[model samples]
Target: MWCLLPTPLCLISVFLLLQAPVAEVFLYVVYKQNSTCMDFRALSACFGPPVPREGLRGYLTEAAPANACQPIGSPPASSNSSEVFIALIRRSGCPFGVKVLHAQQAGYKAAIVHNVNAEQLVSMVADDKEIRQQIAIQSVFMGKSASKHLKRASRYEKGQFWSHLLKYSAYIVIPYVIQEFGFMINVVVCTITLVVCARWYKKGQKITVCTFKRGDKYDTCVICMAEYEDGDQLKILPCSHAWNTHTQILV
Candidate 1:
């Protein structure tokens, strides 16, 4: 659990966590003359798709037929002019895996597939194959409107919009993140302490003593050489005498 009384650092961390606010997410494109953000529907078929990354992952500088990514020998080409090279692919002519894999090898961070019908938007659902499994980039789909906008926008600089996910999404923590960290630290400390105590006890480090028993040899205490009477407290010794002088433990 978290510390009963949170330390100054922990309290400050929690306060900072709460103070940060969530930012809205959107797909955007920036050109020399203009820049705009738009909402797009998407279905990510790649493994680990939920990892928050930049919204601009899959964008290509050139507009080409979707078949360009079909060849294994030749992956899709990215323009050297663009810093963030994402592949803009069409959603037809080959398996989605082919497009994703080819673009992946081409060094694009992500790939966007434009719908075949220009008037329609489609979900990206592909089979789990070796090629598909190999891909580890962002892939999204663009509707008729978004696809055209993307093509037009590609003429300019690529998008730079990203999720503030790593920023404020941490604030969604239950209770708070810093508290959780403190709780884990406390749990580890307590566990280690318990283990150490158990080991010490198992090694017989604990001092143990009880009242004199009936089978004890002498009834008198050797401390004052006094005879033990009824209900009288006395100490037994390993030597040939009865007294408060008991076992001499070597420490």
Candidate 2:
């Protein structure tokens, strides 16, 4: 038997069933030597909110229980107020969503769950509806190799500071330099245009009363040899030669 759902019920089903695609998240790790920074794109979980395009930054710390299948403790206290912590948990013991929920409960900004073995990265799917609904912060799955590299590099602070310092400085400086360069180019273009107009105005032909001295070359038309009369109009060439307005010089 064929049956049609009511409009309201259909709309509700669509809203509850559909899942929007999330953008990929790239994790940055600052190395121990000279703050050299390298980045790896992790697979986002089926659950949790999408990370903002600009992304989040924090120091990496291993989960208290290592697996994070149960409730974990809060992040370690730091004197620096701006310091935020992210939890690193190995993949095992429970579903991905449970691990993420534990990390979220412990006041971490985000969670990175890595593979237990050296396997290719896979998307972390929510095991149950209850856990998925409880998780809020962004959670991503990392490969074993990348996670090992991060664990080694997380011990250094000098490299992280300088790498992030340069990154922030570029965000502010690059736009300002581009704007100043554009303004200078516009000024140069306008100056050149004004100079060309001024030169054209000075060299252009003009109409004036015949008030020049009798012996002056401008007193007569150079092309027609016609003597100038009072109120006679004169056409001036760029070469400073004058002629009657009606006269036509072939060359």
Candidate 3:
């Protein structure tokens, strides 16, 4: 009988364990609306929508698209026409200082960085506020695929792609799993403990009340002037008296 009892309990535990992860995943998917836009290319194109320009000054000199124009409010032309200007570089490879210096040297008006995966966008600033160049900087996460495309397009030759994999794994994936497991264990343990305690308390309980006798040197309840008896339910009043169901005095 004990073995059979454990089988059912184990089955229920397993069922609950399986259901916990599914429920957690469901809640996560429901809550995280941005994860759905993790495709880096899609996110980049959305954020970096082409701004139409009328003049050729803002267009890329190498392969300027016919429709592409300089963005509005660009700084005045630089003296060195031979310098190259680029925008929207990946943030992972390029440090903020280097990007600012590059922008100043190239006379670029702005620089935007997309995240490694391009899932979200952010702005970048130089740590040293003294170098106040007339350049703006921004960042975005390009999701894995979009980041790869940008990397390839930018001709990134050095640095292994997997260098940051361990960091991501440790920070994101492992911590999430550990938190979920801890929550599940706590729920199951608490539920089982509560059930066991409730059953133990209900095993041998009796409901009885105290009986009182008149003039038995007993303290009387101020409200009802009644005395308590053994095994009889007594209500203790604030005026140093115990009251029984029947309003009789026993001292």
Among the numbered candidates, top TM-score falls to: 2
What is each predicted model's overall lDDT from 0 to 1?
0.48, 0.64, 0.34
Q: Write the per-residue lDDT of candidate 1 for residues 1-251, one digit (tens) a residue.
A: 11122111110000012222242122232222122334344444434253243333222443244544553333233344443455667777777777877776766566666676665545455576676668787665555665566566544333333211123243344445677589899999999999998997765433333466666666666555666555444443344444543434355
How far off is residue 94 in model 2, in Å? Answer: 0.5
Write one digit per residue (lDDT tens) for candidate 3, span 103-167. Answer: 43444433334455445434344455543343333212223454444434333232111100011
* RMSD to true structure for each model, in Å: 16.5, 17.9, 20.9
Worst 10 residues of 2 by lDDT: 8-17
Output candidate 2 Cα RMSD.
17.9
lDDT: worst 10-residue window of model 3: 8-17
What candidate 3 gets wrong by more than 4 Å, as runs, is 1-86, 92-94, 114-125, 132-134, 137-144, 150-251
- Candidate 1: worst 10 consecutive residues by lDDT? 7-16
Q: After superposition, how far is residue 100 of candidate 2 from its true place, in Å?
A: 0.3
Runs in model 2 deviating more than 4 A are 1-33, 79-82, 156-162, 165-251
Distance from true position, residue 130, model 1, in Å?
Answer: 1.2
